[model samples]
Target: MNMSWKGVMPAMTTKFTDDDRLDLKMFEVNLKAQMKAGVDALILGGSLGEASTLLEEEKSVLTRAAVDMVDGKIPIVVNIAEQATKAAMNAAETAEQDGASGLMILPPMRYKADDRETVTYFQEIAKSTSLPIMIYNNPVDYKIHVTLEMFEELLKYDNIQAVKESTRDTTNITRLINRFGDRLKILGGVDTLALECLVMGADGWVAGLVCAFPEETVAIYRLVKAGRIDEAAAIFRWFLPLLELDINPKLVQNIKLAEVATGIGTENVRAPRLPLAGEERAQVLSIIENGMKTRPKLPDYLNL
Candidate 1:
């Protein structure tokens, strides 16, 4: 990706109402807090925001709220992915108009398509708006794989400048970097492996767990940026358990639960994607407690 960036860009948390509506005011508080922590940018309305579950209007409201809070102080990238090309394009265009610095584009979800169709889907979105684009590549996250060949193909779009590579495959980092050279700004999308990525020639990170732990997340980034990989890895190793939970199928619930525990946001996930069940809830809590014991104490962003 062409966008010049660095430091922690938390995937960010979305606040929800007791009635399950998108909560904009609390969202602003969270955004401003991240900015105050000296984060590089904000990824609003992203996977962590439960984008897939939000109504388009609710998303627009949430987008406008973030842009307003940021007030041009930092970059804000919106995650706009939908099963339909038109929906994705419209959301991207709307975010651009709403003052987002960029849009993170994922493949048109829900249906499988040939490589040609998949490439075209993204190309059309690139053509639809002038917003800077970051190709969201998480094969595991989407139940689909974006190959090196596809990465090469997509790089042809000049504005498709950055990527959030979340496969947790360390070897692919050098491979993608060697192939793309400086043409792409490869961001480590998975939080647990973020330091390893930076050590292996990746730039920046897209982390979901950071929603409740910006201090540690940004601390690791600053360390890595200063070539303090060993120190960064120490903290990352301690925080790995919490970061890994971002991948659990119940990630949304787990994240919300953590937010509630730390007092950053709420545990009120939307309907259809229900909240945690007995065993799942217990397991996720155990993971968080273990992480707290290993990592630094919860930062000011949390209730703890």
Candidate 2:
């Protein structure tokens, strides 16, 4: 599938079994739900997907699975988070070979690279593959900020086409537009600010909570694009509490629990990371349960 790099593209969580093996069964179930809800692409092994815990070969396996499963119906994008430029490049090349339609790459992990080193890192990875790249720009969490000036330097690479805008600042979307016009696509990376970013003319959303509430997430994008602000805002208001779950530090476990509640996924995560428990689990369940009870009846936005 050709990646348009637009619309709702989920940063999906990697599902695991009781023994921590890849739960491709549940993973495919979530993929079908995302496609059925009208997402444009699937991003695998992201921060939400627990990229750090996954082995390189495991990522390739997931990529291959998604590519074969989607079978050109939608693009499958693999996330690349490595400490070295060579490793990141290798991951990019491997993803391309494994049939990934695109890549979402974070800055050099563990060690924060300077402006020049960071640009070099992305530039080398861009040169390593023919796949389109979406730079994961989340300085708020990642520490290393890919500034607009750095972007100007990166514009030299044609394959570096878009940004997963998770800086937590909505103005960055407008700044990207004002500066680059249509040269670079901006996909909202933060779930809570997704609607605002779309309304501000962002081309897409790299969403988190969509794993559990695909319909609600896609509805906001479709309604906003269709110029139905009032309708979109109504759903957004109802979805705000659930959306907040994506912004927390334990977002992976939180959203997985949501998936369990929605009957679409399991709550098993890899070691070092466990399922939500005690009062924390109860609080998150309360939010998910309440949201499910009040789940809005979505319009046929796909037809629009």
Q: After superposition on all CA atoms, what RMSD does each candidate show versus the true structure?
A: 3.5, 0.7
Instruction: Give model 2 RMSD, 1 decimal.
Output: 0.7
Worst 10 residues of 1 by lDDT: 295-304
Q: Which one wins on lDDT?
A: 2
Shift in Å, residue 269, candidate 1? 0.9
What is the per-residue lDDT of model 2 for residues 149-239, given as tens digits with 9 covering 90 to 100?
A: 9999998999999999989899998999999999999999988899899999999999998999999999999999999999999999999
Candidate 2 has its poorest 10 consecutive residues by lDDT at 1-10
Write down the TM-score for model 2. 0.99
Model 2 spans > 4 angstroms off? none
Error of 2 at 100 (Å): 0.4
Each prediction's Cα lDDT score? 0.79, 0.93
Off by over 4 Å in 1: 1-3, 293-304
